[model samples]
Target: MTRDLLGRHRAVLPEWLALYYENPLEITHGEGRHVWDAAGNKYLDFFGGILTTMTAHALPEVAKAVSEQAGRIIHSSTLYLNRPMVELAERIAHVSGIPDARVFFTTSGTEANDTALLLATAYRRSNTILAMRNSYHGRSFSSVGITGNSGWSPTSLSPLQTLYVHGGVRTRGPYAHLDDRDFVAACVDDLRDLLGHTRAPAALIAEPIQGVGGFTFPPDGLYAAFREVLRERDVLWIADEVQTGWGRTGEHFWGWQAHAHNGPPDIVTFAKGIGNGMSVGGVVARAEIMNCLDANSISTFGGTQITMAAALANLNHALEHDLQGNARRVGGLLLERLRAVAAQVPHVREVRGRGLMLGIELTRPGTDEAAPEAAATVLEEARAGGLLIGKGGGHNTSALRVAPPMSLTVAEAEEGAAILERALRSI
Candidate 1:
């Protein structure tokens, strides 16, 4: 039956399509932090659907709200106001503490980022955008253009080189020495020079923690320095919190809160965990910048009835359960356990990240060189051992991205870590 199902999907889907369904396992249902495959095999999910399923898969409350909202109204054009939409926006604003900030919602993280870029450009009336190297904002044209990785740049590249400047450390090529402080200073100086040579940028966008870029946390005081530079140049700071937001960092409710002493960003974008698996993404900006947007610029499907309901329910659950506090406690335990495992495993190079958004970097036997093949083997082996994980970053895919549901318990986390340890030893 599983084979037949897989065969049908393969036959109907385009051959050119990238297949995440290859070598497939049919997961019939999920609840809490575990999923059951077609044969009734249970697997512990640690990836959290690439950090999207915050509350957990098939959360009863979220499922109930979604079903109820769908029964009444699934979607309506933004021309009319809806109670769910209004309430959800208000909830987000209240949690974020950005009073009177306008909300423009979208179905995906990429769309929210695209909308943010448009608003920034329009408000500042500038063509150029400054972005940090190794940042993963989104996959749209403008967002991709601002992405600092050439691997993401396709055959049809944007003709706006002057409009995009890559700042921060160059992680690839012979020019990779940009990791040094002097090199970072030089990059900043070059950006200032570019501002003088070209024009002041509309915005300087970056992820508080570079998620896809190997989960690399910038050097201490880097965010403050960057914020100061943007302020001096009259450029907006855009914190792309698509993956890092919603208490995953443990330090605060949002990733930007980790850098709050530097002043808040002009605009903030969120998506992944906003609805705890439901499709929802949005932008929250300062009142002045938000007022620059015209109503016509909004999305027709933004903040639809069903999405709003799900978002509100998810937000309420997070606050009521104090999931952030759980994240801090459980995440600390996971990190400590993983670090201990790293000490025992010769292949494990580093374990980095805060809260539950962690990464375990695999390396060659005796060097800092990335061992992607070994990492891939570990992931597959772990899956076969009844644990699910995800991959991210490293030129060759050496990092295992561990972003479990914030509600994961210490015992469950320990089980996942033990599976990982067994996989590593087997490899």
Candidate 2:
């Protein structure tokens, strides 16, 4: 509604409902890689709507597909077959290389993760799930329980049945002090120890490239080792590509491809970029696992005509434009430029990430603790200067997430970086 309405609701709503920015800007419209506020001031959309709008805002094809679908038919219960849903599923499976994969659609990333968890637990008949620490899955009951962040806790959901494994800490990079071989060995050892200490787990879930946990990229060989361990234990390996999927990471269509040596995961979840800012999420699970999930295990507003049409259109657009390739080229340029900026400003701790999903971590001049306050000041200043960014990670650590549309140009990236450079200088 209105800004005043948000403020009023903040006072009366639960903390969860009020967890967003205290003073949220009212965006009126968006096109390509920018958005205009109600007052008509434009801001470069570096955050890409939390890395969801891979194709950019107000994409003509996406809008047209949604409109046509709405005019034709919007919803039909899962009781009957739907063309858009069937087509989207085929496209997803084809792109994901999970032939014979079954698709289950949902309204949001959280729902997809929730469905994965439910199916994993039921299929394995095990109560324990292993998830990486500092990783984020979703905000729903089961998904939140498995998430490593403390923010998603205290749910009414019963049994709290998940185990936590140590994610690579930010003390340095993913392989900070170790070589690839040693890192892989250590991960294998850790998984073995974790399993030895507890009951067998139904699934091991992790973000291929940590998103909310500061865009941490794991070391080479680590994923392969983890996958090996999961295979040995007959544990399902669930790759949560909610933030890194849809060619955002450049090298692959999904984040897991960045770690290709690990082989295919038992189940993979997608959202954020699937519908290019519209609401759509789905899971691609191995045929065996899909068959194991009881028929009608989940049901809701999934695979609706409007959402399916948008998803199909988005997929087609991504394939036609080779957005993944664009993500690689633009992301490399952005990272190179940001690294240069970081060098100029000693306060900038590190710049990392693949493809378009990048993060700039600002730290105290001489301390390890992130300068979140400084980051916030810079973010506000950048917004004022016409670039929109986002912050995440535990403690709201000084990590600025940069995930612009794959269609974002080199010039835009350069300009956005310059604006950010000025913001950093101001701080």
Candidate 3:
């Protein structure tokens, strides 16, 4: 049955849509942190469907809200006064840290970012954008144009003249040997040097932690340092918190807070996990930036009633249950356990992340070269052992990505780590 469905899918779906493993399995249903395939195989879910399932699978509150809202209304365009949309917007604004903020909803992160670009370019009256060196935003033409990762970036042609910046990954860059403070200085120097050569940029966009770039992180306060330089040129700072928002980082609610000593960002774009799979995405900015457009604009399916209902329920449940604390506790334990496992494996270069968003990079035994085959082997072995994980990196895809639900329990973390240890050993 799986084989037949796979063949049919391949015949119809775009080839660029990549699948996991040599034999990809179809996930039929899920509950909590586990999912069942079409063939009745149950495996522990760690990637959370690319970190979209912020809570658990089949969350009762969210399901109930969706069902109840559907009974009344699924969608009403932006023209109408949407109670759920307004309520969610109020909650988001309260937590956004931007004073006198305005929110605009979109169906996906790509659109939210596109909205951000429109705002920044119009406000600053500049078309130039600065993006990080190894980052992946989305597949849309506008998003891809700013993306610096060569593997994911399909084209160099773009309406926005995007210039790539440094300091996304600290472990393997030109200044890898430097200490943390020196590394920050070097990146700032690079930024200042670049700013001197080009026209004033409208905005400098970045992911707090590069998700698709092997979950790599820069030294703390890297962005804050760059903020000083960008501010001199009147450049807007846009934080792409699609993966790092809502306390997934253990220490910060929004990833931008890591660099908040300077001041809040001018604009913030968020999606993924906010709706817990309900397709909620939006941008929050000071009224001045969001209202820069002279004419009217609306997102047809942006804040539809059903999705807003789900988002409200999901947000309340996540906060009320203190899932963020759970992520900090369980995820800390899991990270330590994985580090111990990595000490025994030569190919395991590093284990990095915060909260549930974790990654294990595999490299050649004695060299800096990434070991993609080893990553593939561990993924297949983990699946055989009843575990589901993910793989990501810039060019070689050599890092095992493990971002389970924020509500992951300690026992589940232990079990998942044990299975992952065996997978690493097998590799």
Candidate 4:
């Protein structure tokens, strides 16, 4: 039955939409941190549907909110005044940390980033954008243009001229050998040199932690240093928090806060977990940048009554439960456990990340080359052990991504870590 469904999915879905494992299981239902497949096999979910199931699976609050809102109205478009929409927007603006902020909602991270690109270009009056190497933004045409990872970027033709920048990944590159302080200085020096030869760029967009690039991040304060350079040149700094926002990083509510000593980003785009599996994406920016567009604009299904209700409920539940603190405590334990397991495996190159968004890079034994085959093996073995994780990285997709829901418990973390350890040893 699962194979038949897989065949049907292949016939209808785009080929670029990849599935995990040699044989994919059809997830039928879920509750808390566990999900059941069509075959009646239960698995502990660590990936959280690519970190979108955020708080937990089958969260009663979000379900009730969606049901109650749908009974009244699912969508009324952006033409009418939507109470839930306004409420969610107000909540987002307050937490955004941008002074005099305004919010615009979209159905997904792709559209959110598309809106951000539009705002920055119009406000700065330039078509050039600077993006970090090994970064993934979104799947939209405009967002893909700024994506520096060739694996996710399908084409070079773009509406905007994008220049790839350095320092997104601290483990590999010319500056990898340097200490934290020197690394920040080197990246900034490289940015200054690049700026000297290019046209005036509208903005420099980056992910605090590169999601599809396997959770790679630079030294703390790297962006703060870059902010200083971009400020001098009048380039807007846009933080794509699609995968790292809403306290997923534990220490910071928003990933940009890691560099907040200088100031918040000029524009912040978020999605993935905010709606807890509902389609909710948005951009927050200063009123000046947000209102720079000359004509009127609206997203017909964006910020609809149903999605807003779900987002509101999910956001409230996350905050009320202090999931950020939970992620910090539980994820710290998981990270330490994984690091111990990785130490015994030569193929495990590195285990890195903060909070619940952790990664284990697989490499060819005794060499720096990526071992995608090893990653694939571990992913399959993990599934066999009744644990569902994810894999992502550069062109080879060689890193194992372990991002569970923020509400993950200490016991669940230990269980998942044990399963992952067995999977790694099998590799």
Candidate 5:
């Protein structure tokens, strides 16, 4: 059955669409932190559907809410006043940390980011955009234009003029040798110099933690320093929190809070975990920037009652259970365990990230060269050991991205870590 499906999938899907493992397995269903494959094999899930399964899989609260809402009204054009939408908006606005904020929902992170770009360009009256080096926003035409990762970006023809800036990966870049403070200062100086040569840009969009660029991040307070410069030139700061929001980073509810010494950004975009597998993405902005468009715009399927109900339930569950606290505690222990494993392995170059969003960067035995083959072997071996993980990195997909659900238990973390240790050792 799986073989037949695989053949059909290959025939129908685009060749560029990537699949995992030596033999791609079909996931049938899921519970809290585990899933069953078509062959009736159960695996402990660590990546959680690219971290979209925020709380848990098949959560009763979210399932019940979806069922109840769909019975009444699933969707209506954005013409009438949506009570559920308004209620979710109120809830998000209160927690978004942007003063006098307005929320606009979209179907995915790509659309949310596209909406943000539209607003920022119109308000600043410029088409030029400054994006961090090795950052990825989304896959839409507008989003692709601003993406700096050459591996993900396919074309150079775009509507906006994009300038890639320095500072997303602190350990792999030109200024890796400097201390944290000096690194931040050098990046700021680089930003200042770039701004002088280029025309005024509409905004500087960045991911608080670069997701597809191997879960890399800049030094803390780097953005606050850059914000000081952007503010003087009227350039908006847009934080793309698609993967880092909703307390995935442990210490803060939002990734931008790491740089909140300056203030909240002019715009913030989020998705993935907000709906717990349901499609929910949106942008939050100050009233001034959100209301910049002269003409009216609305998403026909955005903020529908069904998705709002799912998101509301998921948000409540996350907050009520203090899943963020779990992420901090369990994730800390998991990180320490993985670091110990890496110390014993010579190919593991660095283990980085906070909270549940951790990554293992594999390299050659004694050199800095990326060991993509090693990563591939580890992934396959992990699957064989009844564990599921993910891969990412600008360097030939050489990093193992481990982002389990926020509700992960310490026992499960230990199990996943042991499986990963054996997988790495196998390679």
Candidate 6:
């Protein structure tokens, strides 16, 4: 049955849409941190549907809200007044650190980033953008232009003149040998030099934790230093929180908080997990920047009633249950366990990330070359051992990404860790 579906999927889906595992398994249902395949084989879900299922699988609160809203009205477009949309926006604005903020909804992260680029360029009167190396923003044309990961970029032609910067990935860059303080100085110096060479960039957009870049991040306060530099020339800062928002980082509610000494970013874009599966994405900016455009703008289906209802319930439940605190407690334990196990394996080069968003990078035993084959092997072995994980990296795809739902339990973490350890040992 799975084979037949796989054949149909390949025939219809784009070739670039990659699937996990040597033989893909069909998930039939899920509850809590576990999922069952079509064959009824149970597996601990460590990836959480690419970190989209933020709270848990089959979360009752979100499902109930979505169902109730669908019964009343699914979508009325942005032409009508939306109570749920206004409520969710108010809550998000209060939580967002930006002063005098306004929100605009989109259907996906790609759309959110695209809106951000449009605002930045129109406000600053420049089309050039500064992006970080090894960063992955989204798949849209504008978002893809800013993406620094070569593996994800499909075309060289882009609408924006993008200049890639350093410091997003701290471990494998040219300045990796430097200490934390020196590393910041070097990256800042590089940024200043790059700015000197290029036209004034409209903005510098970055992911607090480069999600598709294998969960890599720079030293804390690295962006703060860059903020000071960009502030002098009025370059807007955009924080892409699609993967690191809602306290996934454990230490802070938002990933940008780790570098909040200067203040919140000028524009914040979010998606993934906000609706707990519903397609909800948005951008938050100060009213001045948000309203710079002279022409009218509206996302016809962006702030639909049903998605807003789902996002409101999901966000409320996450806040009420203190899922951020749960992530800090449980994810710390999981990270420690994975680090201990990784030390015993020679191919595991680095185990990094915060909160529930963690990554284990695999490389050849002696050389610095990436071991993508080892990552693939471990993914398959973990699946066979009744655990589901994900893989990502630079061009090689050699990093194991383990980001379970924020509401993970201690017992579930241990079980997933054991399975992952055995999988790593197999390689």
Compare the candidates by lDDT and give the number of the best one: 4
The clash number for model 3 is 0
**Where does model 2 exceed 4 Å of error?**
1-3, 11-13, 18-22, 154-158, 170-175
- Per-model TM-score, in order, reads 0.91, 0.95, 0.99, 0.99, 0.99, 0.99
What stretches of model 1 exceed 4 Å from their correct place?
A: 14-22, 159-197
Q: What is the alpha-carbon RMSD of candidate 6 to the true structure?
A: 0.8
- The digit string of per-residue lDDT tens for model 5 on 252-299 reads 899999999978999999999999999999999999999989998878
For every model shown, the clashing-pair count is 0, 0, 0, 0, 0, 0
Model 4 gets an lDDT of 0.94
Q: Cα lDDT for residue 61, model 2?
A: 97
Write candidate 2's Cα lDDT for 104-156 as tens digits: 89889999998888779889999789988778888877877887767655563
Worst 10 residues of 5 by lDDT: 76-85
lDDT of 4 at 238: 97
The per-model lDDT (C-alpha) reads 0.79, 0.82, 0.93, 0.94, 0.93, 0.94
Please identify which of the two predictions, 3 or 5, would achieve the higher lDDT against the true structure: 5
lDDT of 4 at 390: 94
lDDT of 1 by residue, 1-427 (tens): 8889878977999764443323677788899999898999999998877789998889888999999999998987688878999898887777775656767788888888887888898899886788776677778887888776555544346423324444332343333465557545665565667677767788888887777776766544455566777788788888899988889877678877766776677888999998888889999887788878666654678899998899889888988998888999999999999999889889887788888888888889798798988888888888889998877673566888888899999899999999998988876
Whole-structure CA lDDT of model 1: 0.79
Error of 4 at 60 (Å): 0.7
The RMSD of every model to the true structure, in order and in angstroms, is 2.8, 2.1, 0.8, 0.7, 0.7, 0.8
User: 3 or 4, which is superior by lDDT?
Assistant: 4
Candidate 4: which stretches are off by over 4 Å?
A: none
